[model samples]
Target: MKKPVIALLILPFLFFVSSCNRGKAADEVNGNEKKQTKQLDTIVKKTALTIDTVDYNKRMVAMSNNDTTGRWPVKAPYPLPGALLPYNRIIAYYGNLYSTRMGILGELPRNQMIKKLQGEIAKWQVADPTVKTIPALHYIAVTAQGAPGKDNKHRMRMPFKQIDTILSWAKPINALVFLDIQVGHSTVKAEVAELEKYLSLPNVHLGIDPEFSMKNGERPGSKIGHFTAADINDAIDILANIVRKNKLTPKVLVVHRFTQGMVKKYKEIKTVPEVQIVMDMDGFGDKVLKKDSYRSYIYREPVQFTGFKLFYKNDIRKNWVMYTPAELMKFTPKPVYIQYQ
Candidate 1:
């Protein structure tokens, strides 16, 4: 009876030890599962960080359009974060709010202009379907005048109230605003400095017209003007400074060009991560002439990006019709910026 009683006690102790061991094994398994989950989460975060570069490469490929010329995606350093180019296409209405002859932005009534711009945006969306199309009001903040202004610069600076009006309009539609400068006899640095207040805004960008740059002692419309690489670099420097100071996203700088002489030493134009440079084909003509001009000036001497302008009255004067978004998309390396005047 004593031996049986001892045997029963030993059996209970043995069962307890076995149960303890099983519990320890379960705890170890759970600890390992938690560690594995943490490691997987880290890997997912790493993948998320690389999405910007991957998307940039894909857009470059799409912009290339399988061209054999090798000039479409001009090799350049990747832009800093929050860049607008190559990701979204900009459709801008070019004009001064005061002049009806400049471009569509001022040609129509306020309500009518926004409605027209929205229609154009929709058309581009349908044509591309992949890229997002955004609207812009490209205001001529400093317009080149036939007569010399008070400063003898032959450029009229618009009032701040007008720029404020543009901002007011852009706010409701989420549209970008471009302050275009036709420097006339004045320097780019001077004109750009005057507009620094507006340019400091997040949505306000810049456009410099080489067509009226006027380096020599002649009037703006007397001859087609030019801007050297050095002049363009000055504008870039100012924009970069503004971006860093305000902790703003990158700014887009559009340089208008049609002839080879319009932008001298195009190869030497510097592009910074803070500023995106676009060499725009601003001449208005029939489709063939415009394409040839783009091939000669914009395509030959590559910039960070390219833009194409369509004149409502001028483009149709010879061609009898405007080039549709579908037709323009067929060009090599597709223009990411479209301006209508």
Candidate 2:
């Protein structure tokens, strides 16, 4: 009877050990499952948006507060435009043909200018190896300094012939083109429609400087300019149509703003997958002022992307040094678009 009782006790002990091993196996399986879940959540996936003519509004990817970058603590709510992501960043030089002192774009002829740009791009590549550099030509298609011409449009429009010449320069370097518009007294719809031919091109993009919009009949430089949310939405619609008709990649629409009044009803501006809107802080001052302006205007308002403009001469006033790329990246969501004028 004692032997039988001992045998029963041993059997129970063995069963208990087996049960413990099974529990540990279940825990291991759960750990593997959790790791897979994390990888899926963190990985940046490439998404493609289909072009639709009939249902343009339905296709935009509504984004809000993406996952942390680990590098950038402040993350944008929306997914970045697919074309300019993963690691690549755009560095552009802005200027018009009339002003030689304005920016690198107009400072030199094609060959030497490209050589200089190549050097600058190389420097950025060194500063942030993780971010690839994209070169761009931000040619001012309309100048705000001119008189209101035949149509009472104070802005000077660069002729298509000359604009084509600028576009050709991009081909040699495989750069992108931004035809910046300063409407002066003209409407955004009229201005954007004028550039339909160029905007239709794959490499050509659009930039609207509300500083020169002069919504109140004031000359562009006489007072600050403004672009209503409705005006910006109109521009977006034009770009969307161009993208759909051409079956091209996503187009970027840059709106220039430095003050609170430069853009109104900004919250009402709508975006589509076909169009990526950049709210650029076009004003330049000391590094501190620049950061404050960005924080006040851009960071406070959620947008699809952000752009920072650096005025080569103006930024150095009062012995203020422009913010370097490393420092600029410190903003909550780093600016993907960097423009130098």
Candidate 3:
């Protein structure tokens, strides 16, 4: 009889233990679910900057902060033009021609070049007062040791006289200029430092030629060099600081993308809310086919601004279809500048 009573008491103990275990398991499950929910919330918050849309052609939409109530946020419009300006049709007067001379002559006679370039600017102004001239900086040579030259011998550095000439010509026109630096043997930061004076100018800009920025034993034109996302970010940081110090309008940094690998780190290129960066499509080929290339490249990339190059004599197709100013305005991401070759 005593044994039976003990067994009954043990049964109650077992039931109580089982109930406790069940409660503990339920609490653990609830805790795990809360953690998963928190993780999902963090991921959604981090990806807030990314645009989410099924349509590729539609204008990019962004989230904006809410008004005073801070309850409902609004969507912001896309910043760039979706329809790029047909650069070939845009009038080329003064600054346009001078920009072309950048690569050919590092420095032209200031008196003659400026006078001629300014006259072209005046003529264009007369034709259309509202149109702004997109200025260019010419690429002279790489800082590397064995860049190809007109002669058989290697050409490495740009002469001081050429730098001086470019600066002198730039001062009067109140025009934007770019100091085209070929990063060969030297680092981009070093090259920028060497031309600090020019970069300091309000109207001056910077251009990098990855074509010449190859590692040792690499030859220009045979294969293009790569720029890291970090390298581009570093350059932008430097340029942004300079622009801020000078209290100038945002500086323009131009990058040429002829292949997929040229600017692989393009996303790493910093976005200074103030500066304008242009990724120019530099390939020369069929007009109709090239348009497809442009759409693929521009739409896929993170860049908002783009530039197109038109060869005056070399392009086989004449009377190419181009977007008018009105059409250009319709772009979801509008291009503020245009370039001609």
Candidate 4:
């Protein structure tokens, strides 16, 4: 009886000790989690501060044309002011694998496409030897055609396999990849979110074409679409988050525009250190009309950066030669981004 009494007395002590130990372990884990969370918060705050340091107020002032000759300086401060742009200049081939008429990006066999890209890079190097030219494969990951899919999204998201395959195709040649989104009837925010995983990669960038955004329920290709500055901001904000989390170089955002209606509220599109916005003039015409379009639209607007597009079939329709590297250099601030499609 005495032995049983002693055992019973010891049981409570053992239970108390076990409970104390379990509590200690739980406390340790919670403490560690809090510490990590605090550290990440600090890092994110620092990133936001870095963006705030860039005086957007001075952006317009800096892009001013102090030069009277109307000549775009070859060494102009470009891509963005007060920010480190990834490349001295970017020249990309745009298209999708399914369409030959779209552009040179995916018209040929995989091996042949890589070879042609290499050739174009070599030629651009000869054309503008002063600036570093980056070769990019602009994959139309999503196509917005006239018909709405069964989902009725009015947009078709490229299968992950296709995007991955093209990204793989760019690897052997060491070219950067750009995933362009037409959005069809979808919203830019939703479309960009779907691509967040790929956009987080260091080598991949993004392009949003307001031309097919279809802000309304109107069918794509029936009328030109529009993207407000708010829409652009949403995309930029998403990219900025990826940059901060991954600690990456600034991501480039190519905004395709040739008409005022395509991109509304231009001034409201703000910039952050983690992303660069390039307002590309995407129009096909003769050299004279193209120049006028560039001057009247892109050059006149003064966005964070400027881009020019050349059409193999359309640019040469009326003129003997497309605007060469030297001729494009004549704008007040030269276009640092050029696309051939």
TM-score of model 4 (CA atoms): 0.76
Model 4: residue 272 alpha-carbon error in angstroms: 0.4
Best by TM-score: 1
TM-score of each: 0.85, 0.76, 0.57, 0.76
Q: Residue 74 in model 2: shift from native, Å?
A: 11
RMSD values, in order shown: 13.4, 14.3, 16.9, 14.0
List the candidate 3 regions with Cα displacement exceeding 4 Å. 1-131, 137-155, 317-334
lDDT of 1 by residue, 85-204 (tens): 888999999998888999999999999999999999999999898889999999999988899978888989999999999999999999999999999999999999999988999999
The models' CA-based lDDT, in order, is: 0.87, 0.75, 0.50, 0.75
Clashes of 1: 0
- Tell me the spans in candidate 4 whose CA falls farther than 4 Å from its real position: 1-87, 318-320
| lDDT tens digits by residue: candidate 3, 40-72 | 455544344232332312322211111233221
Better of 3 and 4 by lDDT: 4
Which 10-residue window of candidate 1 scores lowest in summed lDDT?
A: 1-10
